[model samples]
Target chain A: MHCLWCDADMIPELSWKTIFWLSRPTYLCPPCAEQLTILKGKRCGKCSRESDEEVCPDCRWWAADAAWDDPLVRNYAVFSYNDAMKEMIAKWKYRGDYCLGKVFEGAYQTAFKQAFSFLSREAVAVPIPLSDERMHERGFNQAKMLADFLPLKTWDILTRNHSEKQSKKTRRQRVTAANPFQLTRTVKHPVILADDIYTTGSTLRHAAFVLKEHGCPAVYALTLIRG
Target chain B: MDDYELSRRYAGKLLLRHEILIDEPRFEHLLNAHYFTSETAIQTKWSHHECRRCGNQKPSLFGQIPCHHCGETHVYCRKCIEMGRVMACSLLYEWTSPDQPWPSHPNACTWEGELTTAQQKASDLIVRKIQGREKEILTWAVCGAGKTEILYPGISEALKLGMRVCIATPRADVVRELLPRLREAFSGVYIQGLYGGSLEKDGTAQLMIATTHQLLRFKQAFDVMIIDEVDAFPYTHDTSLPFAAARAKKETSTTIYLTATPRQEQQMRMARKKLPHVFIPRRFHGHPMPVPVFHMCYSLKKDLQKSQPPKAFFKWFHHRKTPGRQLLIFVPTINLAGNLTQKLAAILSNSTTMAVHASDHDREEKVQQFREKRFQILVTTTILERGVTFPSVDVAILDAGHTVFDEAALVQIAGRAGRSPSDPTGEVVFFHDGKTEAMREAVRSITRMNKRGGFH
Candidate 1:
């Protein structure tokens, strides 16, 4: 098999369990997987941002906001935004190499299972939506693709108004901008939002705020990368 | 904008929709006026695989996804994705209007040097082929036999008759190196040199110098197409490159292939007299090819594995006839090149020794510094085997029996020596532990070329 990102040949590892049970196919080679900077030893209790304190400053700002009532959102990211991950995401998202999303399938599923296990009840995976203009431009929602890796039911219960890309905005602008997400349908079950990146936790918080206002009991995020 | 001016920019060229970058209203008007033709960027053949833009049909290099625009499964070609996203849902545009006439140049070539008797014969053949619009011809000249100079006369003749000419090579380094020399030769004509990330995008030049990869953007664009180093890597290996070259030429155009070593099929065609051929056996300096001296070093791999310098290398270094000549050592792999560079640096106590490979970020800068004599020794892989010239360098191939060092590569590596006219004779050595058939053929080919050059 060839790696999805680098196109290098990947020799499947043969373990005792795989001899009879059959191993899950992998889309990334070992060297390409090694280049992904998986996040480790982080102190942020909420966002998985590598920090010395219990919560990162960005998450602290989201907690002190007065617009909503006791908004508690937790984000789980598989990898940090390293140069290699940045290039991989750029190729998959902007360059329209959609098959590269399969490279993250194994990692994303493993991270989701570990994060979603703590929920008291079953939680549905809700992908952060893109505006109609953005959807037509990109032709596919990247968040929706990552959400497809989850085994649970995926809910498309949110809609977003057209806004400038969060990547081009400053930290202050991102935290202070009006929320773009609106609930398409109400949900009573716990929610786990899936997105390609979680930067400053503003987008997820803004998304979570809308879900919570619609009488959702809890909201959390599972992201591919943490910038 | 003038309709002709806008359409002329895209005449005889294929461009993705995003690459057109024009006002949508104007583009639509041109389409309605029947000046532009549009088609799906990617075409699905009977096998359900094909990239219409680059002619890629490899199933493994294609991907399918649920496209939001079309609301169905869209297959995209990943082979040529670096150029642009050529998907089934996107569109490729071509201008169908008549081509704008190129201005003829009365005097194109300004080079004052004269070709040797052997080179003059090949140059005249090329001119006649271009004039008569023959299908193809091969100029099989030995390395350093004034291959670039022989093309000036034919290209000048073609440009004088208001014909579009393109000189495409397989390497970008050759394209960059040839552009300045071509400009100096044809000073009055408008010439454009194209490669990846090049600034010149408007392909309206009468004379063009481009890499074979750049030819993918052209469609029936050139009247005379010259392919230099026709047997080099990626061109001979990749099917898409040759397909692009064939697609870039008009139906009735002349193709001139330049190479030091033609593949077996090309040689067969020449022997059968199916393809016109010319042979220049000697260098422009009137010197025979440097024959390589083989030295058996049975423990070469063992020493390299132990991170120690081989004893045979020091013996060869001390017994060198010209110790002051620059040193070029070719290894089989990049890992070996790095290990040997450190080992040689420590042994000779020379800090100027460096290693270079295809992916090295400072590759271009290091080659430039080596040319300026900033470094005394360069350890490299087969990437430096062809299309590069170091005036006076003694060449050495460590591990010459490795699978990577085929017959063609060995000959090209030996050709690096004895290139300069002033210092034409440099030592070439193959330090091997075992002699393979490829090594034998490489040595035999060099001997045959020397004999054909009247060197006995």
Candidate 2:
């Protein structure tokens, strides 16, 4: 086997204790794995951003704003948006290396379990949808692939209108921009949004607000990176 | 688009359908006029599998997915995904238009530097091979023998004949270095340099300097193909690159390989007299290549674990010949390079010492800074083993017996020393815990080259 990111040959280390627990195999080598700064230490309760307080200031603003209707939205990210993660995401998302999605499968599974551990009822993974024009260009929906890694049922019931990418907009612009997501069907169960990244917590908030308006009980987000 | 511009840009090039879709009306007109050819980008019919773009046929490297365009399960090639995603539904574009004659330059070479006697002989042999339309010829020249200068005469000859020429290497750094030099040498000709992120894609230039990976976009494009550093990485390992190189040349094109350390198959072919060959063992400065002195550092690993070099390394550093020259340390892994860089920086109390590897984002800038003497000591991996030159730097290998330091790599790493004409003699040391066959073969090879260069 070879590393999905760097293409270096990965020699599977065999030990006599291999019969123990059946954990998912990692797709990264030691050095590449070390580059991933997983969300650890003190973090915001609402968002996974590293913070000393219970909630980050940005999440606090979203809670105080009347326009948001004080929606219940919490985001859990797997890794920090460091330089290494940024490059890896660029290669996977923009450069269209589809196999790189497999590199994060193990980590995504772990994060999915941790993020949904507090759920009292069953939740469906809802991938954030791309606009029609962008979908044709990008070929595969990254959020869909990420949602596939979760053991829970995935419901892609959200449709997005053609809007500028959140990455291209400023934080202020992203927060103030109208919601691009709309519920394609009435939601019966709690929703967990699956996305590749969480930047400024606006995209998740917009989706969560829409789901809350549609009578979905609770809304949470599971993202790969906390930018 | 103008007829002349279309003919010049796409006459002998391969482009993706999306690349040519910018002007749909003109493309449709050209298609109706029989001036364009289209084919499926990925071939997955029956048991046959191939990627028309990068020529990848590995079944394992292909992925099947629900394609948006085709609205079905489509196979896409993952081998050359960095360039672009080539799926089964995608189309590749090629111009079937009549070939336009390239402009001729009677006196193309503008380099004023003189080649040495051995270099002049090799240059003449290259010119003869190209003029005779030979299949291929190997130029086995020692390091610092002015391999690039030898190609000037041959390229000038080809340009005088109104033939397109290209110099492809495996390393992008070489393309960057060769672009300026080739432009300066052939000032009258239009030159294009292609790499991973290069913006210029006109492909209409008469002279091209590109990395081998960039050649996948070309089809029978050049009349003369000069592959530099033929034994370097990716070229030696990637099977698709050699296929790309062959497909990028004309039917009767001449390929001239330039390498300092030829691989085993090449050596065997040369021995069997089945391949035309030329050898230049002398450097441009007429100095013997630096021979490496093997020093045993038994406790090297223990010392490095504690973030320090062995005492013998310090002893050699304190009593050095030409201590003012820059130092280059080659380690087997990136971990060692980073650890040693920090330890050396602290011990020497100099902030200029740094480490670089293949994945370093600031690698190009660091190398440029090192060229300008901004860094006194640079630690690196095998990424700098070939296709780069530093004027006056002493070279050392920390783990010379490591499996990564093969014979060819050791020779190339040793060649980093004694490159400039002014600083002809540079020190080289191999600090190994134990000697390996690769180290012995490297020493023997350097000694044999020195003997051929008339050094005692």
Flag regions of model 2 displaced more than 4 Å.
A8-25, A120-122, B45-48, B305-307
DockQ of 1: 0.58
Q: Give Cα-based local distance difference scores for all models.
A: 0.86, 0.87
TM-score, chain B, model 2, is 0.96
| lDDT of each residue in B1-456, candidate 1, tens digit only | 576576457777888877786888978887898787888888776767778778888777899889887779989888887776788888878888888876788789999999999999999999999999999999999989989999999999999888999999988888878898999999888889898767896777889988887888888888999999989977887888899899899899999999998899999999999989999999999999999889899898887677565678789988889988889999988778888898888878854799998767688898889988888999999889998888989999888988988888888899999999999999999988999998999999999999999998
DockQ, all models: 0.58, 0.60
- Give the DockQ-based CAPRI class for model 2: medium
Error of 1 at B190 (Å): 2.7
Lowest-scoring 10 consecutive residues by lDDT in candidate 2 chain B? B17-26
RMSD in angstroms between candidate 2 and the native structure over all alpha carbons: 2.2
Report the CAPRI category for model 1.
medium
For candidate 2, lDDT tens digit of each residue in A124-205?
8899899998887888899999998888788989989998878989988998888898888878788888999988887788
